[model samples]
Target chain A: MAKVPVQFTLNGSEKAEFIESGTTLLHALRDKIGDTSPKGGCHQGTCGACSVIIDGELRLSCLTLAETCSGADIKTTAGLAEGGVLHPLQRAFLDAFATQCGFCTPGMIMAAKVLLDRTPNPSREDVVEALSGNICRCTGYEPIVQAVLTAARANSQNAA
Target chain B: MELRRDYFADVRKDGLHEIGQPRPRLDSPGHVTGKTAYFADRNFPGMLHLKMVRSPHHHARIRSIDTSEAEKHPGVVRVLTAKDVPHNVYTILILIQIGPEDETVLADGKVRWKGEAVVAVLAETERAAQEAAAKVKVDYEVLPAVFDMEEALKPGAPLVNEYHGQNYYLYDSGECRKVRFGDVEAGFAKADHILEQSYQSSPIEHAPTETTGCVVAPEGNDRFTCYTNTQAMFFTLDNTSIILQMPGNKLHFVGGTVGGGFGGKVDVIVEPIAILGAKLTGRPVSFIYSREEEMQISSPRAAEKVVIKDGVMKDGRIVARKVTGYTDAGAYSRHSPYGAQKGAGHYPGPYTVPNVWIDTYCVYTNRTPSSAMRGFGVTIGDFALEVQMDKLARLIGMDPLEFRFINAYRDGDMKAHRQPTEGAALIECMQEASRAANWPVAEKYMAMSSYRKGA
Candidate 1:
């Protein structure tokens, strides 16, 4: 197997690197780039555990090959906090207890963030519709929905 | 969401939330942040990948195995057959009758079902390991397989387990668990009407976002480190120890942040295979099942056919209940006996009855084995009994909710299985739900157009 040189922006920093052809983007992020934000839950795309923002779009890192991310700007859940303060969504998630087992949280939160960013103030039904794809076995999807609605409400109130 | 002064006072006085309050889960952060390290993501130095060679025939006598090509492959480090297995049998799920002494770690001399592991191959690369596994060949003397329970029980049908001398997996004497209270016949005689119905549930997958996978690394002398997505970590460690002929202290089992179990991942699916592969290579070996493999091979909800009978009076009081459950045990009676037993015990559906009888048959099937899932065999049974009650209520020209309210088990109602239900909250839940949804009105909405959509 030949080591292929691939260059990509990770989180915020620019990077130029080479990886094996078979190296999944998840492996590249965790091993090469040292970003552990994209967890490998299901190697397949079934579990959104290995989700990353590629070119401002949420994508499963496990399914994406390293070669595909050569020119793409990547964002991870670890990049959510700008400085010392928690992102409002992350804070609301913590306050609302929207997480359990925590494995699926990153993907779910990223997915939620995408939805919230697209529509700052979403309804309860909209929240459910947003996070439906990300499966949370614990809490039966109730708390997560509540947390999203809470985040949306907070965002709207802050705007006001 | 608020309640009485006493209830609301706890929030101010003790600074505590409601006990049943809808709080979000606690583990979502680690999961959402990608900080959670599920077992398959772990990396180690000199790590090798493992793959298995499985049987194609459901029932077969292993004639011979050819692994020369696979062993000679460029990246392949080791190829193992049953001859290499130190332990003959290892149980994955230990319940009544079938304990840690029953299941096979590797197919030894005979393969009982299709997809049973026959050989394991280890290579430096996962792709290489998979490629090399295809090189290994096994010859088998095919035997007629039995896919039906009734056929297996017959005198001359092909025996899946001839060594056991009977088709019965767990209980040779029949009843997994039996409970007797009042005379059911006498209790039924006092009732105004008797209702009997059979309900069947299809097999369902847990479909846990994560598929079964395990990474096993040799720690020291006969000791191994295992990281897998298993619900019952202790059970996996114990069973793996027994199968490897190693001490319990020699094995360490770590559960990854499982995506979702719903009880399916409780059974050890990828552990033994990974362990066997690691043993062959003497290197860190990781084995991950494909989604298709996970779906077909891993434990599923037991497909059940339950027959429930209830004797109710004119006033909607249930006097007697009898339930019979037939659960498809699949390839092995892993947790079927216990699951079926629990199903039988819970079937009367939280109702008050003087007499009850539940019979559960853990019948055999050639498909993947059935094990635990959410509700632990209670949910399906509950659905069956509740639907029956609704149908019976409609037949008697009474409102379903009213009928349920009339016969609802309360603080002092004796359960069908003879236990007194103390602190029964069904009525309270019903009242709250009805107040929220408006019961009679909700029923009216069910009759509304299917095209209508709203929250």
Candidate 2:
């Protein structure tokens, strides 16, 4: 089998690697690049467990080909904390007890960050729409919605 | 299965930290940070991928299996047929009744189900193993199949297991569990009005975000480690040990971060397949069910048909209640015997029927095996009884809430079967729910509006 060389910035670190032509971005980040924090859950992109920020846009890594991710800047769940301090959304998810089971939290948090970065102050419906793709079985989406609203309050206070 | 109440009395006083409070799961951080490794994430050097070649026919006599073409494929490691499997009848999910073991991990001389595994393929790549699986050919003599429970119960129907006697799994005419208390016939005779109706509950999928997946490998000499996603991890470990014919200590079970169970993940599904694949390849193997496989092969919630006969006195008190329910325990009796017992335990609406009789029939079907879901069997029973209660109340010219409260089993009251209602809060929950939902306004709107009984 012929190996294809791919280069990308993962969690702000540059790396070049060789992966199979059919390798998914999820397999490359997890198996090849030794970044196991993004998770592997339904490979079909239905369960958003493999979500990562690619070129500053939230995307399902399982659905994206390794070749497509070449020369792209990607951010994973491991980059959510700044120098050991938890992100506002992460803290809110923890404090509000919205992180039950937690399989979808990384994707949900990344999805929320995209919404929060753009909106800064999102309504309930906006928050729902932002995290709609991410499916959480335990929390029933109530606490997750509340967590986003709480994080929005904290973010606005920090901005002021 | 033996029916017994497993409720912990005075459990609240045991510890303040045990229940009611939001105790954060210890594994939350790992899962949230994507640090929790699942079965599908596990990988080893020189590991092989395993895939099964399933039978398309629901019931068939296997004439021949030609794996020569598949074995010659590039990257293919090995192809295991029924001749390789030691156990002719592989049963991980055994029926609770202790008779009629009705399943196979890999089909032997006969294939009873459509998705029954016949041949297993191990290859250098998952894609290769998958591609090679499609090449394995099996000649089968197709037989008559039965898919409906009622049809399966009828005499002269196609037998799922011909040795199990007359298409029925267990004797006693489909009614696995029955309960009788008081003079139900005499009570019905004395009643002013009698109501008979049948209600059907639909089958629902668990739809767990994480599909079933497992990775099996040799831990060391005479030992193996299997990582799987399951609801009852310890139970699955015990079942896997029995199926593999290995000692408990020789098999190690590592649980993956559970996506969701809702009671559906309690069965043995993918772990055994992975273990079988590992044994064949002598290399670490992982088998993850695709979404389609998860839906078609994996167990779903059992559907039920309930028939209720209610008797009410002129004074708005329930005189007697008779209920007969048929549970569609698809393919195999996974949890049906116990589910039948629970479904017929009590009619479980907040009413005091002086006389009662309940019987549950768990019939077999050709669909995916039915297993536990949320609320076990009580959820389906409660809906049927509650709706019938509402209809009965309307017949007696009384408000449904008032009728329910009049006969509702209180904490100290004896139930229809003369059993004390331990820790009952039926009235309180109903009142609170009514207050919370603004029931008075809703009721007034329904009464004032042109919403007749049929409309």
Candidate 3:
């Protein structure tokens, strides 16, 4: 099979690469582009560990082919922080001690980022509903839920 | 998550710093940023991907295996069988003198359970390895398999494990792990009423977010560096070294941050094979279980069947308790033997029953070999014991909490294992739980303490 060429804006930077026809965006990012943020949890979109924000929508990278993601803008958990400054969600997750084992943190943060970007002042139930796709087996969902609420409050206070 | 005002008033007489303080995990930033170096995160130059050719039949004799088609695949490097393993026979518990080396790194002659690896194919890519693995054919003579614990133990049942020479692994005394304290029959003769009930639980998976995996890099002078997510690092190093027949120092294990082991990753499953693949190919090799494989093949919590018989007095005192149970260890003993022993040790619960007897059988079945999970042996036993306690309380028309308060173990009590109980806090814990739940206790029960009685 011939490698197909792909170009996309990744983490606010333009990048170009050649990928196989059936290569997933996750493989293209980790294997080809050398970005290891998005992890492969269940390669079957059931586990949201491969979540990436593409064109202002949260999509599972494992389900999205690299060819389909061509010319799209992608954002991963690695790109959330700017100039060494932590994103409010990242800061709040740390402050609330929401992460354990940390394998689910990247995808969880990515999913939470999309939620906060769209609904800044999401209620506890809203956070729970938004993060239903992401699974963190260690924390039992309480600390992560609390962290998202804390981040939402912090973001609202900053805006005020 | 607010702490109750009197939550630790009785337990926190001694000041503590790290015990109840809010401390952020050291790895949270790395986790959030996706910069943490898990075993799968690292990629090496000229690294080969390994995929196992597993058995489709639960119980079968391998008539023959044909690896020609797999070897002829374009990117396939090498295919290894049990013959390639230097020391093929192993059980994780062998380090503690608890096994007869029942399992092989790869299936040897026969596969006792479904999904047992028979061949390992190394290739340039994971897809190529998986494709090649599917091509390796095996002719199997399927045999009748027994899956139930009790059925496997009956006379003329299909043998599940040949290493043990029986369906059950015997303790040093040549029987099931036994816990005999006092004359239970005599205690029962003096009782007013008796209750008997059976409890059963299916096997449970740990289902950690990150599945079991390992990456082995061969280095100079026969040294191999392993990056894994195992909870027990030294156990992996020691067991993998034993399996590889190499010096313990030759394998340098670099791991501590498990994605969520919960006792699952303690089994030395992938490291030895990954190391062997690296050694045979003279290149780095990575072997990771897919989520399906992890769920299907990885060792799960042993399913348990417990029968609890209690002799109780009208005053809510348990005169005698006998717990006879079976822990389905599946086809091999990984940790189930020890887990069964632990279950027997936790018998009669945390109470002061005058007489107690426990017999826990580590029974084998033609299922995925069960091993450790969170609280492996004791958790299931506690499930049955506590439920029995609740039922016993209800039968005698006593409040469950008050019944427990009356029978809770105190310090200086003797356990069923002939060991004196020390620092027992069941009374205090029940009191705290009742207080938290606002379950009103009588003034007499409230004064109950775990401190040494009659001191």
Candidate 4:
């Protein structure tokens, strides 16, 4: 099989990799570029573990083709931290004990990030709706929902 | 979340530390940053992928398996069958000297259930391994299969496991775990009402986000290092050593980081074969179950059925209780035998019944093997027992909470299993619960205490 060459901007840096024709964006990032923050809980899109931001829109990397994202800009959980400083959402998650087992944390954080970007003052129902795609077997999602709500409250207060 | 200070005020020390404060977890930073090292995160150079070829039929006799086409496929490294395994038979409870380990690592002669592994295909990539596994041809003779426990226990039913001559797991010298206390028949004859009801529960899957998986890397010194997401680390290592017929020192297990396991990852399932692939080829081997494979092949909590026949009075006093229970120990006996004994022990629902009789059977059937989950044995048992109590309370036209307080066991009361109760607090718990819910009862019922129990 011929390996197809693809180039894209990842985490504000130019990245290039030669992958197979049907390789998923998940394998392209994790196996080739060596960024493994996005987990692969399920190869299908049902589990939002491999969720990433593509041009400011949340996308499921497991279901997206690498060749189709040749010139796209992508961001993952590895990019959430800047200069050793954690994001407000990450801080809220830590303080609220939202990340248990952590298999679903990355996707959950990305989902929450998108929801906050669109709706700065989201209600509890909005937070729940944003995180409906991700599944966390532990913690029963109470801590996670509270963490998102806490982060939203902090962000809105700063804006005000 | 209000705590009653006066309830245990005498024993409570002043200026207590670390009792009711929120403690931050140390791994929160790694978890929030998505930098925690799970088993699948680590990768080695030139690692081989392992994929399984499973049985399509629930019950079938395997005539032959021809791996010629699979071996010749592109990027295929090796194809392993039951013949490749050194010592195939293993049972998870054998660490505590539980007898007769009968389950095979790979299906040898016959497949008793659907999705039982028949052949393992190793290749350069996961896709190639999956494609190559499909090329391997297997000849099977389909047989009649039984799904339910009661149907399997019937006379002349098709056998699910040949290890036990009968359908039910043998307990000491009886067909079930037996519990006998005071005479239940005599207590029932003197009762004003009899309540007999049957309750059943369906199987529950853990369904953790990360599927069960492992990666084994062979070191230069002839030792293999396994990175797994198993809940029980030492149990997995010891069982892997026994199944591979190797010394424990030759295997270095790296774990204690599980994604999510409500007792689902306790069984040693994906380690042995992945280790064997590494040992044979001198390369790291990764065997991860897909979501579909995890759902269909992995063990779930056993479905149980319990029948509770209680002898009660119009005054909400449960005099006698007899229970007959059956747990569906599907195909192989992984942990259901011990679970049945636990089910038998949790009888009559914490009430102070004078006479109690309990018997629980672990029966085999042709389905996915049932093993551990969160509160496997006792969760469903409690569900049935509490429901029965509510029915009895309704029958006697009394408040369920008041009825429970009337039958609540005291600290000095004797339990049906011949054990004296100690530190009994059912009454206190109910009283606090009523206050929390803002559901008021009569002042007379509110004055009841667990120290002294009566109507």
Candidate 5:
């Protein structure tokens, strides 16, 4: 098995690694690049625990082949925070007690980040739709939904 | 979520400072930062991936297990079968000295259910391990499998577990957990109306986002450091030590950070074998369940069938209550026996009845073994009891809540099991619930309280 070159801008920094050809972007990021924000809840694309923003598009890292993601800008939950402060969505999730078990938090934050970036002040239904791909078994989804709406409300108020 | 108006908060103690406060969780910082260390997050150098070769047949006697091909597979570290385990047979309840050793780490003689692990293949990579596991051949003689609990209990039916010597796990007193309070027959004879009903529930999977898994690393002092996602860490350590025939001091189990247990991660499923693999290879071993495995192979809450027979008066008073329940324990008795016994204690419901009889049987069937989930013993029982309450209320032309208020268990009231119930609040709780829902209750029902009973 020969390692192939994978070049990507990861979390505002350029990272180059020679990874296995058939390796998933989840494994490449977590196992190779030492960024463990993207969890491998399921190897299948069904569970969005491995969700990452690649080339400005939300993609399931487990379904996306690592070698095919060459020369792409990838963003994960680890990159959500600024220099020292927490992201508004992260703070919202933390405050809302949305991270029970914390397994689904990374993907959920990533997915919500995309939603907030695109749709500021999303409705409760929109927040629910955005996080429909991510599964949080512990929290019955109410807290997570409330967390997203809280962040959205805060963001809209700040803009106003 | 809107905070409900609590009627009892006014009389509550002064020490209750955090009742309705929205507080941050202690793990919030780590969780939001994506740094909470789960079992799978640990990346050990030279860690061997372990995958299982499962049985496709529901009931099959293993004729032979040929692991030669798997062992010879490229990058395959080792292939292990039943013979490799030091003390193969065990039960999770063995720590409490509850049931006999009824299960094996790997199928020793026969696999009682589909997806039973028969062979373990360890390799350099997960893909290689899975491929090598597929290479291992297990020649099995398919046997007749009985899937239903009642069907399995019939005469000449195929036995799911021969160790039990019966389709049902035998309690010390009889074949079932029995609770007899008074003469239900006499009460039924005097009752004005008789109501009988049946209730059954399907097995429920926990389906936690992160599946059951463990990473066992061999330390320098001949000790194994196991990082698991088990909700019960000591259960894992003790069970693993006992299974491996090693002293408990040699194992350092690090856990308690679970990815949504919901009473599902209490089983000591993966740690023992992962520890064995680490011991044999002197390298870290990771045994994780895939989504399919977590759904199918892992034990879920028991599928239960209950028949409730109640003798009721014209005034909605339940004179006699007889409950016959069956716990579909599946292939083996994991916690089903204990769960059945626990279910027995909840017989006749919370209402005080003079005559009550209960018999709950933990029956075995050729399916995945059932264990604990959220509210394992009483949840299903409560469903049947409450539904029966509603039915009895309908028959008597009475409000369900008022009917319950009349028969509600109170302080100094003797329960079905003979224990006097203290601090009973069913009456007040119902009163408050009725008020909160804006359901108009009669003056007498609204005035009822648990403390001032018969006043």
Candidate 6:
């Protein structure tokens, strides 16, 4: 099979690569663009470990084809921090000890970013519903939930 | 955040530092930033991908395997079978003298369970390896398989493991693990009532977020370095070396950042085959199980059946307890014998049952071989024993907590295995739990202590 040329904006940087016809966006990001943030967990849309933002919408990179992602804007956990300053969610996660093994952290932060962007002050239930698709076997969801709530409060206080 | 000083008023005297202090996990930043180097994170130039050709039947005799089509597949590098493995027979518990080396790195003559790997294909791409693996032709003759523990034990049942020479693993005494303390018949004869019940649990999967895998790079001539997520690094190194018949120094294991082991990664599953692939192809080889394969083929916690019979007095005292249990070890013994022995050791619960008898059988059946998980042996046994206690308490119209308080083991008491108990805190733990739950206990029951009354 001939490789198809794909061009896209990744982490606010225009990137181009040639990919196979059936290559997942996750493969294109990790193998071609050398972005290693999105992990291959289940690779079946259930784990959400390969979560990335496509045009302001949360999408599972394993389920999205690189060909379909051509010319689309993408955001990943790697893009969340700027100039070595951690994002609010990342700081909150650190303070609250939200991660254990850390395999699920990137996707979890990405999921929380989508939720916080849509609703600045989400309730605990709102956070839970947003991250329901993401699975973390380590922390049992307590600290992660608290971290999201803590980040939301900080964000709202900054806005005030 | 204010510290809850009152809750730890009693525990504060331990003079512990960092125990109560909030410390960020050393790996959290790397985890959050997606910079942690897991086994799958590393990529090598000219690395080959490995995929296994697995058996579709639960039990079958492999008459022949034709790898011609797979070898002819584009980009396919090498096809390995059991013949390629230098020392094929391996049982993880062989170090503990608990096995006859029942399992092969790849399927030998017959496959005893579904998803047993028969052929390994190395290719330039994972897709090519998977495609070539699917093309490998295998001729199998279906055989009778036993799926139930009790059915496997009956006379004339088809043998699942010929290594054991029977359906059950034998201890040094040539029977299942047994524990007998006092005369249960006499204890039962003196009892007012007897209660009997059976408890069962299905197998449990660890289901770590990251599946089992390995990446082996040929470092030097006749030397390989394996990057894996196995919980026990040296165990993998030693086991893989034994399987490849190579020196221990030839294989360097790089690991310890396990995503989540929970006892699942203790088995040397992927390293041997990945190392073999690397050796045969003379290229770095990476073998990772898809989520489907992990779910279907990885070792799971054993499904267990426990039957407890207790002779009790009217005052909630269990005089005699008899336990007959079976651990479905599946087709091979990995850690099942040791797990069953742990179950036998945990028999009769943490109580002062004067007369106790326990027989734990490590049974074999046609299922995915069970190895270990969190508290593999004691967890399931405690589940059954505690539930039996609760049922007994309900039958005698006694408060469950009070019943436990009355029967909780005390220091200086001897166990069914003739080991004297030390630091027995069952009574204290129950008291603390009851106090926290606000369940009122009578003055007499509340005064019962784990410390011996006379001492």
TM-score of chain A of each: 0.91, 0.95, 0.98, 0.97, 0.96, 0.97
lDDT of 1 by residue, B13-106 (tens): 7645666477655565555455567786677788888788888888889888899999999899888777677776655555223652445656
- What are the Cα lDDT values of the candidates? 0.74, 0.76, 0.89, 0.90, 0.89, 0.89
- Lowest summed lDDT across 10 adjacent residues in model 1 chain B is found at B446-455
lDDT of 4: 0.90
Proportion of native contacts in model 1? Answer: 0.58
Which pairs clash in model 3? none
iRMS per model in Å = 3.1, 2.0, 1.0, 0.8, 1.0, 0.9
Tens-digit lDDT track for model 6 on B361-405?
A: 999999999999999878989999999999989988999999988
lDDT of 3 at B190: 94
Structure candidate 4, residue pairs in collision: none
Give lDDT tens digits, candidate 2, residues B1-455: 22112223223334434445566667766655666676666777778888889889888999998999999899998887766654435444452334455666677778877887788888988889999999999999998888876788888888776535554435353546667778899989999999999998777788776777777887668677888878878778766766666677877888856767688778776676677668767788877777777777777788888999988987778888899887777666667656766787756456667788887787776666678888867888988988998899899888787677667775555676568767665655555556667664234322221112221
Kindly provide the TM-score of model 6 when superposed on the true structure, using C-alpha atoms.
0.97
Query: Where does the lowest 10-residue lDDT sum fall in candidate 3 chain B?
Result: B1-10
Q: Which portions of model 4 miss their true places by more than 4 Å?
A: B12-15, B451-455
Candidate 3: which stretches are off by over 4 Å?
Answer: B1-13, B452-455
lDDT of 5 by residue, B1-455 (tens): 34445434554555645767777789888888888888888888899999999999999999998888889999999888888899999998889988788998999989999999899999999999999998898899999999998898899999889888999988897899999988999999999999999999999999999999998889999999999999888887888888999999999999888888888888888899899999999999999999999999989999999999999999878899999999999998888898998899988878989999999999999999999888887899999899999999999899988899889988888998889998787877788788779877789887766666463
* Candidate 1 Cα deviation (angstroms), residue B379: 1.9
Docking class of 4: high
Clash pairs (backbone) in predicted model 6: none
DockQ of candidate 1 (2 decimals): 0.41
Q: Looking at model 4 chain B, report the run of 10 residues with the lowest lDDT sum.
A: B1-10
**Candidate 1, lDDT over the whole model:** 0.74
lDDT score, residue A154, model 2?
100
Worst 10-residue stretch by lDDT in candidate 4 chain A? A131-140
Candidate 2 TM-score, true structure as reference: 0.90
Residues B164-234, candidate 4, lDDT per residue (tens digit)? Answer: 87888988849998888899999899998999999998888888899999999999998999999999899
TM-score of each: 0.85, 0.90, 0.97, 0.97, 0.97, 0.97
